[model samples]
Target: MVGVEVKGTTRLLGLIGDPIAQAKTPSVINPIFASRGADIACVPLQVPAADLQKIWAGLKATSNLIGFGITLPHKQMAIDLCDSLDPVAARVGAVNLVRRERDGSFRGYQFDGRGFVRGLQAKRITIKNRDVLMIGAGGAAVAMAFALIEAGAKSITVSNRTLEKAEALASVINGDFGRLVAKAGSPRPQTGQLIINATSLGLNETDALPLDPGLLHPGMTLAEVIAQPEITPLLSQAQARGIEIHSGIHMIKGQVDLIADHICELWS
Candidate 1:
């Protein structure tokens, strides 16, 4: 009786993604809301890349919907759709969470960066002065790379399938920090203290590993941005090879409190 009691007055939130069946945001963040005795519930909203614009309009017009979360393919696309962005979201050029204002406008925010750093820090996984090899150059990758540097990562090398995209992301991060901490390189992962798979490659059974498995060694810790399946092939392979691995679940856990406050406006 001391938990959330969803009723007519309960507000709703959603996690939107293309292949949403595996998302852990709802399960992870719901309990935090319940503990606060708030009448809020978050559900999954599966929308293909094509239908995102249409769904965004609908979610905005709906009542009792305070905000929603974004993941995967939509994080970058959702940026232009938002009326405004929080500082981090603007700086990272991605939006993972959006709050619907009373006047039918939406404000976007990015927690992926700080949440990621917190996730690793919570486990005593050292980030400071570490060299990071990040796969993919999409929205999430962009945020994490910046955060890694902020957390005192000595260097970050972005490696994407498309070499140009990786280079561009590195250029952006470096230009922002003005310290030349991030650079674009191949996915071969020649050198790094941490290896991050920030791509969608491991989301499917038939997907290939983001990097050369042979390149992975004991010196690097493999981390993921995918939450579902709990253990992706990348993590499994890395573990089998005597490498330390971190799952996307920690990223989910890392963002729970931030998500709660943003979506429910608990602090407001």
Candidate 2:
């Protein structure tokens, strides 16, 4: 750990989520602030979705609470609570970063999508002109697919338990990035260089891989968006077969940076 210049009066940032114990924000964001000589500390706040509005209102009233990193259910709710929203967040209809303005108003922005693209770049993965096979069409999945297309991915294939949900996300992506291939037919598509898992699958005892590991090839690189249970079952299976693996931790760090940038740009 690097030493940082901090006064007794330093401000704080935090993450708000229902199940925040497994989050990697503190581990990643705190070090980032320290290394950057910022007089700030990021913490984790476990707040359920039902209490989000109440908590957010109180947070806005507090002076020491510099900003917040929202997760899961809170992301969508934060958008509703914000006095203003960044265009990216508005388009995605979600907010993962929130900070108070000079007029005592709070604004929200979506950073996860930008972070996913940054994480891929940090790992030397190229989305431009690459065929992507994304598993899961959940919130994060939708955000990543949209971000990937914006980053110039040649084409994408989204797979989810419900084919219609996957098709919905694909439609949105196609609406922005040209023709996106949707695989809902009997035969699943097997051609893709990048395989990303944005599902909460393989995160707990009750969860399992969305698809079989036998389908993965060694040439394929996998990116999982689940951080808890660090080595998810999907990642474990991929490792067993020698497939390149990118952990959810990378995305956490990437999002932290994007949020920090937003804080400095808009708040500072």
Candidate 3:
């Protein structure tokens, strides 16, 4: 097996999330750095929700580090931790990428939505006028809801365990779009023409399905934001039922180039 050589002069990059073993960022991105002969390495940090703030300090103090990618719970919480945000991330209220400056201040950016849209487009999945049921009120969900609407999805229902969080996210999308294309609703599998699992529910075998599999019909297309276990339990169920399924890896694959370029710019 081949690997990038890490040495005293190698720069560092991190990907942080709970249950991070399922993440594909380091494997997907580190090779780009190697091919370009960049003295950089991306590593996964398995940080549960409770310890994010505790570790944020250590991340900031690492001089050899550029910044880290955020996922799951940290995506939203890291917004406050950032010294500034790209307007897209500010509007989405979640950050997927951060660049720590020489002064130790972190600037945040969100590319999840763009990547997701590009993924769907690349696969020729029709987004225009499709009613979407997005499960999750966290960072990735909020960003994708807006992207879906902007991509001409007929409407979107943001569903989450906490009803208020779902409602709040829908409200932001509607407010920003100046239309009622998004709203809070339960995760009823039959309601959406396109259903996306944006939560971290599929990271482990013990996690529950985001919705009732029995309700998934043949006409609907299902997608995800969880990159590992490409065939998540939900996707497996959907595929068994002959429903069109899209994997989470496509989302990362769609945007990895942007990520590599952003890091190269920062390094320069």
Candidate 4:
């Protein structure tokens, strides 16, 4: 038997967000694509919320552009740009993955929620019947909460700097998931089995945690979805506290595989 040679021009995939310079997707996914013999190049696109639609619309006609992984403000905005939404994406109300079809129509999907669930499982973190205390109410926060519930979390308590935002996220989850253990108050949800820092609070060198470190116990597992600085401030605290820490790198890895598969399925 002889090996068949495979080769192609580099196809471009990108991540679009306001503070895109902080994104690690290009570094993470590019190597994976290269290892798989995929001639693809990934870039971080610093696209403001106001220009998301314009930038995406322009990509519709670009033949060399393969796909995009959305972030921040655009994750929710992408729902409006897609020709269709996958069921998970619809329920989460966020679209992190966009697949450009042969006809140039992009259908939106969300892999973050699903990826988080799967990544946790890969790490032997059981979601079923676990009490979850989720912090932050932004796109990533919302997705993590929903993913935990869908994976059969026993209870969930959400907290954010803005109580109203946390409550609003709870409303959407309650409407969709039918009775999650959501609340807003002081002391930060009493620290459940899992403590998730979904906020960007730990992204900066000087950012303090939304909750006091005394609230986090060694028995609980601390997970943060912030990719930059790899070892985030929250994870640093968790380490000193003797709590188990899962880095944002795992979530990024999960998305890389799914994103690659989505592009190959849709474009190849």
Best by lDDT: 3
Across 1-268, the per-residue lDDT of candidate 4 in tens digits comes to: 0122223666778788887767888887776676777767777788988887788878877778878888876887788888988887887888887877777778788888877887788899878988888887777777878878889888777777788987888788887866646655443534447878777777778887767777777678888787887788778877898888888778887678888877776554
Which ranges in model 4 have alpha carbons more than 4 Å from their true place? Answer: 1-8, 185-192
RMSD (CA, Å), candidate 3 to true, equals 1.5
Give RMSD to native, each candidate. 2.0, 2.8, 1.5, 3.9
163-247 per-residue lDDT for model 2 (tens digits):
8887877787666554645343221325557888877777686786677788887777888887887788888888999988888
Which 10-residue window of candidate 3 scores lowest in summed lDDT?
A: 184-193
Q: Tens digit of lDDT per residue, candidate 3, span 1-268?
A: 1598889998999999877778888898888998888988999888888988879888888889998888877998999988999999999999999998667789999999989999999999989988999999888987888888889999998899999999999889889989888889988966448999998888888999989989898889999998889999999999999999999999998888788889888683
Please give the TM-score that candidate 1 achieves against the real structure: 0.95
lDDT score of residue 226 within candidate 3: 86
**lDDT of each structure?**
0.86, 0.76, 0.89, 0.77
CA shift of 66, model 3, Å? 0.5
Clashes of 2: 0
Q: What is the lDDT of residue 226 in candidate 2?
A: 77
Instruction: Let me know the TM-score candidate 3 reaches against the reference structure.
Output: 0.95
Ranking by lDDT: 3, 1, 4, 2
Error of 4 at 89 (Å): 1.2
